[model samples]
Target: RPRPITPPCDLRLQSQEVQVNLGSGDGARRSMMGDSSTLLSYYHEDAKTMYEVFQRGLHITGERDGPFLGSRLPNQPYKWLSYREVSLQLAEHLGSGLLSQGCQPSPDQFIGVFAQNRPEWIISELACYTYSMVVVPLYDTLGPDAIRYIINTAEISTVICDKAQKAAVLLENVQRGDTPGLKMIILMDAFDTQLLEEAQKCSVHIRALRDPPGPDDLSIVCFTSGTTGNPKGVMLTHGNVVADFAGFLKVTDKVIFPNQDDVLISFLPLAHMFERLIEAVVICHGGRIGFFQGDIRLLPDDMKALRPTIFPVVPRLLNRMYDKVRA
Candidate 1:
């Protein structure tokens, strides 16, 4: 005799068991979402793509002027960047600004994002998605040679960079005639006039301003050094990332993240999948995210100031923190 499967409200979704036969029978295509197959199909869902992730929040909150999240430097109070559910948001404006500058929308068109974790980085990424363009993140680990290789390989015409020192690195490549396709470098923070002057000499346009809401979708391309060859790119479409978010929530939502008034200190490199995945989950749950002060030495100060409700760290950092405390 069969009885009821109780606990109606406390369901904890578990990952499907791994199977040996991937392409046989009702195989790998079989999923918890009975009808869904490719993760990229996440695009066809309610949000459509990452471009809509923030705007969806705006609709839910129904707020017009308040900021979507927070980010700031040391000694300064946290700052907010208003993200109304507008045809009126900064992301759209950035996309339009690029369009006005003749950077047209195309699935193949790529933009390089070289910045630390900040509210601006997310906004710039959303802007890329809105414009039907892709993001190729250039991180510190990639260095100059690889940065040049990626720019030429991706044919990136514009970049959104964080600091003048970083912009100077990209400009060095430009001066060497390595990243010829590169045309503009948008600054996320204030810089000395020297950067602008240097930019002019390299035939690059540099500007520091608020930018965005464009609609549509794009993808991401990350690079890794090949074992025996040069750097190689691995592209993840909109579906790839959002699907990760959906899967994470189903498994952890009820147990670990039941509370919605969540806050996170975002110190991880957004260029990596793990941190971005953390962000996706947080955003889905209406969580607040704050960045660390750029200096690792000031991380404790940033944490104290941000007073986060959530902290995500790797084993390496955990061990370092433990050792520091013990010492």
Candidate 2:
């Protein structure tokens, strides 16, 4: 049974009256230990309540617990966020209030997350999930033309970009105006406060004005690389994410809990599904997350500070590492 709501008023006076004999044939009985009894009773009443809370609209990444854990940085100096912070902030940003205030929501909320792999990328993706927004993740290494096509094809309205991809976003904006959906662009660094303020004023509303998405709604539209030409958006539903996460838990059940303190060095592009999935896992676990200060070029320095437990990589990065080792 779920627990009942307890108000502050009744907390102080709460007491237990049960007393039992330990050597009795039925079983060992016990007496209530003042605060212990009240605590047990409160928790007992809350069991069902907690379960229902979880069943309501819990997210694997955004919720308080799943996979993402507390800070894994060896000599924990500062506090880091868990999946809850990532999801809630994302929810607030992508909520109806914000989306309706001219900023678009999912399906049509063409927001591009362009950067190399990092916790922010995953948080941005989760934020998209909260509002059922379209997520267009651009490869960090793509040329200007490819970048232009992706933003144009998606008709991106807003772009959540890193310092490296800021130039590409602007270049695409300058290339054309036929993109009716493309309206505002924001930056994550907070360096360009002036630009951020200006972008916010554009009022390019794209949220499904009338009907907002539910928890089970389509959360993101990821684009896959095309052999022939432009990439195609792969529509992923909230259900799909839940299913995938469940599978992941099954396989990594053993290491999931004990290694919850593992730190992950994210070096892959946020655009890649593998990195995205791992980020999702990290969010689900309420783990401590840190961003790489510089690009992959400064990997040695970043690792010295991070010393991540889980280091995800692509074939290209692996090959480079292998080459370096040989050298």
Candidate 3:
């Protein structure tokens, strides 16, 4: 027999009279059946830019000795990146290196990100933001034709890819003269001598931008999954992202309060809005993020190993977990 559920003594039905003022001048009031205790609110000043939010997060929590981001290592423990190390890498290595390489994309120009959820992916994203380049995320599961469509539609000149297979596809397109405007392809992983030599021989001049992008400028162009037809692009500004972060904080401050001690296990694709938003929120709160191994079948083991406090997931994943539990 199944165990019966118990009700708490505090559960009760009560009616309370609440008065709501229409405005300051009108002096009108309306009666509502609710108590003040039922209401919750949170307030915060809006940030001027997304970069400003990041800067504030760094200012508040960068001094802590705890790791800010981590990834699982093969047959070993997780490798971690401290807040200070992340900042240094963004400033000294990824950001500066891109600039030195002359990867100066124009305002509103799309820079493609073709990779899985990794530290390099985050670095590339932040580096693009630092120079005001618009990002176009390309999912790893997308085929060559879909990839070609996005590249052409967004007029992506430069692309940052993680694996050799993706790079080969892009190289094939470039060689076949399919992507006329394509200039450079940056591989996050180490590349062979032949690939590097071939890339150098291309006409694309890999250079950095001269000026920083403004808050109102378009930051990213997210594409829909295109279950119906062709994928469509949705442009969002830096201010839009900043406002969203601020709004989310205002709404969920009481329910989901993240702290330095909290650990967030990242499994969703960074290209998804939910994951990206949560990542920004976690960083703002100085929480640690640990990435799962890139296989869904390993999620249970990863969860066990990471022991995360917060798990943000989609309905499909949640349903699967529930089914597994029931089974």
Report every candidate's CA lDDT: 0.72, 0.52, 0.70
- Displacement of the residue 89 alpha carbon in candidate 3, Å: 2.5
Alpha-carbon error at 225 in model 1, in Å?
3.7
- Per residue, candidate 1 scores C-alpha lDDT tens digits across 1-327 of 546434314345423554657555663422443223444434224554566665565554454343456878669878765456333667788878877777878777788899888777887777777777888898888767888889999889889988889888888888888888889988887899888888899899987746122223447888887786788898877766777676655544445652335678888788888888778666644556788877888888888888877777898998998999999
Q: How accurate locally is residue 241 in candidate 1, as Cα lDDT from 0 to 100? A: 72
Candidate 2 lDDT over residue span 60-143, tens digit each = 333244433222233433245544554455444544444655655545666677765555565566555555565777764665
Colliding pairs, model 3: 102-206, 102-207, 102-208, 103-207, 103-208, 104-207, 104-208, 104-209
Report the candidate with higher TM-score, 2 versus 3.
Answer: 3
Error of 2 at 18 (Å): 63
Once fitted onto the true fold, the runs of candidate 2 whose alpha carbons sit more than 4 angstroms away are 1-79, 82-97, 104-108, 164-175, 178-180, 190-216, 254-259
What clash count does candidate 1 reach? 11
Query: Per-candidate TM vs. native?
Result: 0.80, 0.61, 0.79
Compute the lDDT of residue 176 as modeled in candidate 2.
52
Residue 40 error, candidate 1, Å: 9.6
The runs of at least 3 residues in candidate 3 whose Cα sits more than 4 Å from the true structure, single-residue gaps closed, are 1-46, 197-212
